[model samples]
Target: GIFFLLLFIFLFQILYWSLKYFDINNDASLFIEDLEFQDKLSEAIDLHEIKKSQEPAFFNPNFISDYKGYALGLSNEEIDRLHQYRKAKKWIYSAHEFQKITLVSDSLLMKLSPLFKFPEWANKQKVIGAKTKQQQFSEKKNLNDINLATETELQRVYGIGEKLSNRIIRFRTRLGGFVSNQQLFHVYGLEDNVVKNLLAQYEVKGTTKISLIDINTASSKVIREFIYFDREAANGILRYRDSAGIIKSWSELEKIENFPLDKIEIIKLYLSL
Candidate 1:
């Protein structure tokens, strides 16, 4: 009983201190002052916050801030794609290339690209010894055969530069060579006007040399890998080939559902039997 009494006294002392420790202060200004002290301590911890209000207006889009990207209506995915693309040490030299990297829609490209403000040299076309677009063309012969032209020769075209010329040649190489002037339209960043100009200067005199796949025999993977045959179209082709027989002609391939009917002719260039 004496031990129990000592325990009660100890507990009472502990409870009193706990209650006093957590007692709500009635002095409102003290609470406010405590908050103000915390505010000052946070400011001292991160001084950069103090200068955030002094950030510049209208920074280059290449240096876009998160707030700027959000304000410009760029989705986080689009901004991330642009950043990932830029991480490759590549620069967006033109609006076309910017659109290619980010895959922003046409309306967005038009709205955003004008404000892009590419560096000055991007606008400057270098000529061996000339002042103007016409003079540059005059110095170089029109690119007659796109297949045989070097990157330097490709660059002679008004719109083609180092990056674009490499891209064109790389596409040409990938396809063995450009089979038609129309194929130039398929290069990622080439604009329609640029393609038209490319067509004017260059001709796809090289042979159409797409490595063909047998429609009846090739696996779905091979069929699907061809650009003309999307997954649905490829599956249809395989299903039809298995259910009916070898796709005897382009007409038969076209009859399959979602076969990209308009691209039938293009498909013919890649498939056989």
Candidate 2:
């Protein structure tokens, strides 16, 4: 009877061990499946679309907090440390500074480097006092003919604000230059009347070999010079051409209101067709 009881106890121990092992295996499998499911769901989300969404739910503080928590799994202390580090350094610091910092990882540094201030260690390092003299000289130099000058040069023109300076630079890049005083209308914030007032003051020699009237496919600048059209009108013509297809004939100019008969006649001598 004693031997039978011992044999029974041994069998019971074996059964209990097997059941525990099976339970552990099942739990592990379940955990793996859950992880995979979450990964798939994360990949399915369109991050760009979510970022662009108009609703506060997409960009609100609460959503951002949840998103950071899910993606980084950073502790509150770690997050606070990162914030403190960022605050101590200028927002515009260079990538080198990021690399030098021991607390920041290479991947994280690369991601954050673009937002930081360019370090004083960067090339062409200029002293503050030295820069003032150079800037004064540059401004003095820019007071010369603006038509021949670069955007940086144009900034020196008296009464030209930062916004206006940027506009001039952009216009120069797009259309090449202010051909006629009329072309200034293409610049943002420069009102037509203001342009008309300023046109006589600034003289621009047209250097573009492609005359407005010469080509079947005229650029925005050519169209501007041809019809004395504003930026809006030039854009309208381009949009119309794109939508309806190419301009088949000069007579098609009639369809565009800004292209008057007299202007068309004046431009006919210069056109291809």
Candidate 3:
């Protein structure tokens, strides 16, 4: 009986080894990953659908903020390029024009262009608003509209060459349009005679109101950006403001070493108490 049991165990072991060697599934895939493929594909499709359904309502291409630009998938460099272009008193009115300035990818343009809602007038080549001097007045247009004065109008002033006129315009732009004709003194290369010539022809009359900076509260950076204030002068003002809060009067500026004592009267025009 023991011998027969041993012989039966040996036969069973031989049978198991033979079956394992001949197994048809040995060369085939261990498991089907294709089963999970449909689930992943469905998940991706649902995400795409959700994004499409939740599209933003309205955005003015004219004023895309940093966050807005980021949400719209714009790179920092691309957004900055658009801002720099706009800072020079230019506007982005259309999808093509926006793409031209920002230079976004073609795929991104396609995605964002459909959402662009520009001002109605942007559709036309030239907007109807803000007519030029030529359009607003007749050929003999001699008015002291220095803020609205074109290069040609500026050239009409004696001693103001193309360079001088352009310089004046640039100064005006940097100051967000001049507050007073006295601001022309900020223009470089302008001789006393040329300034008198400019004064005779022009004064600061514009459509935009000047927003004065509160020297007491303003930062060094804000003061530095001022047309007349050099970096040292701006920093000095900030130091004074920090040490002694709520500057009561311009007389306190006398103590600040780098303060522009010469331009105090003119600087007063753009500073609040």
Say which candidate scores most in TM-score.
Answer: 3
Please give the clash total of every predicted structure, in order. 0, 11, 0
Each candidate's TM vs. the true structure? 0.43, 0.30, 0.44
Candidate 2 global TM-score: 0.30
Candidates, ranked, TM-score:
3, 1, 2
**Candidate 2 structure lDDT:** 0.52
lDDT of 2 at 70: 38
Candidate 1 — worst ten consecutive residues by lDDT sum? 121-130
Colliding residue pairs in candidate 3: none
Candidate 2 lDDT score at position 216: 42
lDDT of 3 by residue, 221-263 (tens): 7888987788888888888777887789665766786887545
- Between candidates 2 and 3, name the one with more favorable lDDT: 3
What is candidate 2's CA lDDT for residue 104? 48
Position 199, candidate 2: lDDT: 40
Q: Could you give me the TM-score of model 3 versus the true structure? A: 0.44
The per-model lDDT (C-alpha) reads: 0.69, 0.52, 0.76
